[model samples]
Target: MNSINRILIAGSFLLLAACSPKIYGTVQLVDANLQPIQAAQDSPQGSIVNMINTTGSIGQSSHAVTVDVEGKFESEKEKVTPGMYKVEASRIGYATETETVEIKKFTGKKIEFKLKKILEGKRATIKGAASDEDKIINPGEVSIQPPSM
Candidate 1:
């Protein structure tokens, strides 16, 4: 093909690529009860640090930048795109939860995650009983014991 034809072909290809739509979404952080939490305040690296340090969990993903002013999460709404994403939530002193979010062109979806605090408690309990059907043991007896402190 001539140079003009080649240039025309390349331009057409570029035009088609530019016309293609894009897909996007955001990751939000919430309490175990799913209530919106405030964004982290100033940090050397930014709010993500405060969020990671105070709450321990990062936003599900790095794409969703931290919006401390807004209790809720937000992201740029882009052109139509389709795909599945594994959203994640993390915290230092809390249990992390992840979920899948689907995005489609010309539409928006929300993927909210609720994280729970990492329990740090000492507690225990034990209880049981025996019936006539349990009497056939070599020594049918039920016993309970606590720490020998």
Candidate 2:
């Protein structure tokens, strides 16, 4: 009779635990100088958008998350098993950066990303294909001269 009571109690505890949800840490975006910049002042959305994905080796894939605008980026409170995740930031015309994050049981984390110059060079060469033969030729080098538009 005592054994039966112990089994019932243990089963009930497991059931409750399975239904509970766990929360993970967050990520942020910064500038190349490590200064926290607010996402674009003209951001239509109030919250920063973060896109999360996997990378690296098998089972060792990292979570690549990106946020546009300069602000602290947070992930949805998810029930994730404790593990090491490679968190990265993605943005158009911005160099992406990655950071390692450890997800704990309860505490949320703050990750930051600095937006480095996305432009590889001040000038870009415009190449064209020569009709005479399948040859590549540099038609011209377009300088990134900011116009007074």
Candidates' C-alpha lDDT: 0.45, 0.49
Candidate 2 lDDT by residue in tens digits, 73-106: 5554342345555565555545666666665554
Q: After superposition, how far is residue 37 of candidate 2 from its true place, in Å?
A: 6.4
Candidate 2 has its poorest 10 consecutive residues by lDDT at 41-50
TM-score of each: 0.38, 0.43
Show where candidate 2 strays beyond 4 Å. Answer: 1-70, 120-149
Off by over 4 Å in 1: 1-62, 67-70, 77-81, 121-149
Task: Note the residue pairs that clash in candidate 1.
Answer: 56-91, 56-92, 57-90, 57-91, 58-90, 60-88, 80-105, 80-106, 81-105
Expressed as tens digits, the lDDT of each residue in 14-88 for candidate 1 is 776654533222334445575545556211111221111121134322343442333344443332244555544
Output the lDDT of residue 62, model 1.
33
